[model samples]
Target chain A: MTPEQFAARRQAGWAELESHLAQARRGALRSVPAADLQRFGVLYRHAASDLAIARRDFAGQPVTEYLNGLCGRAHPLIYRGRPVRPSALPRFYASGLPRAVRAAGPYVAASLALSVAGVLAGWLSVRLRPDLAATLIPDSLFDRMARGEVSGGIGDAPVAASLIIGNNVKVALLCFCGGVLLGIPTALTLLANGWVLGTLASSIHRDGIDYRFWAYIVPHGVIELSVIVLAGATGLMLGDAILRPGLLSRGDALIAVALRAVVLCVGVASLLVVAGLLEGFVSPSDLPTPAKYAIGAGSGVLLYSWLLLGGRTRRAAAPRLQLDAGG
Target chain B: MLPDLHEIRTADNVGIGYDPAGIGSRFLAFGVDTLVQGVVVIAALVVALALAPAGIAGTLAIALFLLVPLLVSVGYFAVAEALTAGRTPGKRALGLRVIRLDGGAPGLREALVRNIVRIIDLALGIGVVVMFFDRRSRRLGDLAAGTVVVREHRAPTAAAPPGLPPPILRTPDAGPAIDGVEHLGNAEWGALRTFLSRPGMAPDQRARLAAVIAERLCERLGLAPGAPERQWPPELLLERLYLQLLPRMAPAPPGHGMPV
Candidate 1:
């Protein structure tokens, strides 16, 4: 048959499918009448079959191109990703986050170790040569310490909380994404942050207000630092995918690890929210030093317990349909 | 024979092809999205600050100033893509949609991952460079999320003039016989069909293009290139050749060459 004759015979079905798709795109397919919904499926299958035939017989023709596009548009409607459920969020916190963290334990440990190395380097450098503290610590912070203030001069708790949250989340995201460059940026970020902490601590120690500084920092620092470490871990995991992609190609490996890394990032973001709240409200408050330390230690325990033990008894959740992102 | 056609097999065993959006369109879309995001953030901050009462409510305004832009930067793409099943305002304007490698709409998780990774992709024009090297023009976010941005097929415009009618071929006995027509590939056949179906060409230009195509077809068929144009006009010869090749190009009947 001529291309025109073939198009004439199939045009009605294609038009029907197109209309159904338009309706589906506007709202949900479920909104369509039952009879029409069934017809939509049938029409889609027919279009799919027609696409196959056109690809074989009418290759390079506009008819084939049209059929291919029709099917491409319709395929996603037929095969959607798993629907979002309210339970998914709660379930993720209870198990998904912890499970992913455990799965990527080695990377996290490496991240922690890198940060510790930075801390030690900064601390030892400052301790050995006190003059180094001038360069290592920011001038505003040093001047504040040189005087008698330990608080961050945050006037409004809510404003500071939002700013802290924004900054922390940005840093976490940067650390996570830096893994694409083979983990160099991720490592550097962790070390740089840790070095700043160490230098500040050394400077505070020299001023004899080390205890006061810890009281202020520990309330939020415990969770904030952990979240940063977790973020670094996610980045390292991405880097590992590039560095040692096992059997898969480098792109495939990056994708495979990214799924879990993103889940960890969500957890990191959640923790940073908590930390930011504490930093803005609790850390700067006139609370007793012992009480602030207690809050820090208690929260750390709660956080680790959740990560280490939160969904151990349950069987794995039913596998939901996850669409692969690659071709 | 279209370039950059990314094909995936569906559960029905049919191959569906997607045309990946190229770097130029995606960059344009990004530009639009950035402008939209900036406008939205500035407007939101203005309204938020304007509404802030004194004392406690004023703190909220300050907080909004710090948080609003960051949230919008990440949330804008993620929420838009998730809600629209793959398109943001910019993408829709540019006729692009994001889909999984397996040709499914991205869910919220995919959307979040894709956008969060955009931090790196947007840094220092890294995404553009990465897309340059990637076959599907995927940036780091797409590679990580396993998704691709594809150009949507535009519906035929009503303003377009009606296509020319198919060329009629004389009966085999009435016309000069043409042989070895099957040797012409789809490329040659497609060129002939395009030449025949197109309208509004100057007669002289049409005759010239037809002669060129007919000569190529003659050379492919092992006949003297100039001989066929002598007996029949080059356009007439092409129309006849198109009709002769039609049956050979028709797909096999169902259950013969159909995908199982």
Candidate 2:
């Protein structure tokens, strides 16, 4: 048939689909009336077939290009991602984060190893040289340590918490994004952070306030450092995908790993929020040093236990849930 | 020729084409998004400070000052893309949408991954440099997330069929005595129809195109390329010739009348 005749016959349906897509775009397909939504589906299929016919019979024509575009616009809506349920958030924390952490255990171990090596290097160097402490640690922090003031003179707890949360989250995101460069930057960030911590600890020990410093550091440092290591592991996963993408192409491997890594990063963010609150409220509070130690040790054990054991029951129950749904 | 088109086959085995957004448009979109982020951060700080009435409320302002910019910078693109099915406000304004490699809408995970990676992509202009080397103009973020930013196909507001170009006025008797019109094949007839019926052509461009097509057709018909009929405006001559050929030519095929 002539292009005109074909277009004339199908133009109404195409226009109808375009309007329906416009409505869907404004809100969603569900927002359209029930009858129109059904019609939208039929129209989408008809447009897809029309595109196929036009491609075969009318190659290089504007009509084909137009049809291709029409179908492209409709395709995403038809196959859009599932709408997020309210339970998805709670479910992610309860099971998803731990599952991801378990899957990335090796990467996390590597990150921890690097941090430990950095800490040892920093500690031994400062212990031997003593003068290196001034250069290694920031002047403000080093002076504060020299004077035996460990709280960093935080004036407002809320302000300090917000600042800590922002800084830590930024650092974590940087650690995660640094993987795009094959993970060298991610490794360096972890080492540098650990080095700073080690230098501060060594300096505080020189003044014989080691125990007091531990009281201030341990409460928040446990969760904060663990989350940082987790972020580094997330970055390392991306690097590994690039370095050794098993069967998939490098891009596909990175994409697959990134989805899981992002989940870990989200968990990292949440954990940082908790850590920030503890640092601002409990770490500098007038509570007894033992109480502070107990809070730190208790929270660390709880956090690790959750990571290791949180998702197992749900996974074990999955088959039964599926059966119940099927029945 | 049309812009670069990438085609992906759907489950139904039909190819859906997409125009990957170029570096220029993407850069503009990024600028727009950055501007929007700045505005949001500033507005949020202003509101936070305004609500503070001294005493304890002053701490809230201080907290917001520390947090709002960072939160907006990190959350804006990821949250916007996820909620809007892969379009940030800037992308929507610029007619761009992010889609997965398989041509599906991106989910929250994809959005978060890409935007988080965007931190590195923006560093030292690496994203632009990478896009220059990539065929699909994907930056490091898109490469990692397996997503592509594509130009949306905006349907014209008028509901007219795009295939039907402006109709050519018919005046069969006004034609010169063109012998051997039957010598023109389907391809030649299609060229004539497309040139005569195409919409939105500038007069000079239409004249030049008509001259070129008419010259070629005259040569094929064994008529003198510089024949007296050429003195008439090329479009007019082509129109008359088209009318004369209409009766003898077979019905135009599906591809015949449309411009590429």
Candidate 3:
């Protein structure tokens, strides 16, 4: 039959569905009469049939586009149902976060080992010739440390907290994004950070106040350093995809690891907030050395417990993607 | 030609095809979002500075300067994405929305993951370089978050389209005279041919679809519903209907549109 004749017979049913859908979109679906609801299903099925027929008979016509749009609009109402729950957040922290971190554990281990080696090399170089520390430690930062002004001197805890968090997050993101370049950039960023840390340590030791510096850093360092490590690891996964495609092609391998790496980035970013708060207020406070040490140790235990044991209640299955082989 | 179409399978097992927004469209959307974010950050800094005490100095001043603006810039995407339920103002303007592949709404975690990974995409000229390698035109953020940005489909706005000509029936004649076949109309006759043409479907689906077409055709044609002649199933009934209608259905003018 001609498209017009098809429409002539079915337009009334389509119009009825249209009115019902309008009401539904307006959040008035509950008030829609039961009779209309029943008719909506029949109309939707008929429309689906029309679409199939249109593809076969009316191909390349405006009628096909109209049917497709109509079906597209109706499909969600017919089939979509996934309720957002408050419990999902708790579930993610409990199971999703750790499972994600563990999945990228090998990458994280590689990042850790690489950064540690960078650190040892930095320490060795700086210890052998202390003057080289000037190159690693920026002059402004060195001056600030010398004058006891390293905390940005802003009295507002929030301001300090935000700065610390923001800076660390940026560095973490750089470490992560750098992985896109076959991971060389990622490794370089991590090494740069590690070398900087080692140079700073040696410079602080030269001031003969290394003990005091440790007390100031330890509270936040415990959490902050670990988060950076995790981020570096997550970033390295990008490189791993390019470097080791495994059985999958390079593109597919990248996609495979991208999900887990992104998830890890999410978890570690949250951890950075905690570390930032500590660095802002507690690190600068004249709290005794032992108290600082205790806080540092306490956070270490807490962070590890959260990562290693928080989600041990069940073995969550990883999500699997199903790709269609097209005809 | 580039293959930009990707299909999302609904729970009903129907595949819904949507064209993912291309990188060019995405960059435009990002440009809009970034402009808004930049204005917000500047306004915030202005307020912070105007209200601050002159005595403020040292690490605190530097900290506030560095962090608050950064938070606003990044948080603009993450928080707006969540509260807007997967669209920022830019996406809303562009008629784009981030949707979870699994069919649910884009949740907070997915939003955060996608937005954070966005920074990485931004480095490569805002996903321009990365999207080409993806099947769905996804940047790193989308792939990682298992989300896709699709144009929000609009409902049909205009009148229904013109009719199709009657298909020339290829079925060898199915028995002699099926009664009351004239009321079936050209469209109904075309529909029967459609049902006959679909091949290689699973047996059950084919039978079910054939039955539905038969029932609809019977209702439209004023024929007795169901298999009155039990020996001849609906598919066979359909074959007979097409055979009877082919000669009777009128043909349309040449050059009327038909799919190749």
User: Which residue pairs in candidate 1 collide?
Assistant: A325-B101, A325-B146, A326-B101
Q: What's the best-to-worst order under TM-score?
A: 1, 2, 3
Error of 2 at B219 (Å): 12
lDDT string, candidate 1, A239-322, tens digits = 999999999999889887887688788776878989999988888788888999999999899999999998787664444323
DockQ list for all candidates = 0.46, 0.40, 0.14
DockQ order, best first, reads 1, 2, 3
Better of 1 and 3 by TM-score: 1
For every model shown, what is its TM-score relative to the native structure? 0.88, 0.85, 0.69
DockQ-wise, the better of 1 and 2 is 1
lDDT tens digits, residues A1-327, model 2?
545655766788788888887897532566778888788888888888888877765566667778888888888877766766767888888988898899899999999998987888777878999977778776766653443344545457778788788889988998998888899889999998888888878876886777878988899989999999999999999999999999998888988898878878877778898999898878877789999999999989999999999888633778898999999
lDDT per residue, candidate 1, B84-168, as tens digits?
8888888989999999899988877788778988988888989989999988999989988889999988754323312335643
Model 3 TM-score on a 0 to 1 scale: 0.69
| Model 3 agreement with the true structure over B1-260: per-residue lDDT tens digits | 12565565544454445667777777788889988988887876776676566555544454566665667666788778766556688887787766666534465556666776677777747576668887777887776666788776666643633434444334566686766777766457555655665555687998898788777776766655453643467777788887777665435444432221
Model 1 CAPRI rating: acceptable
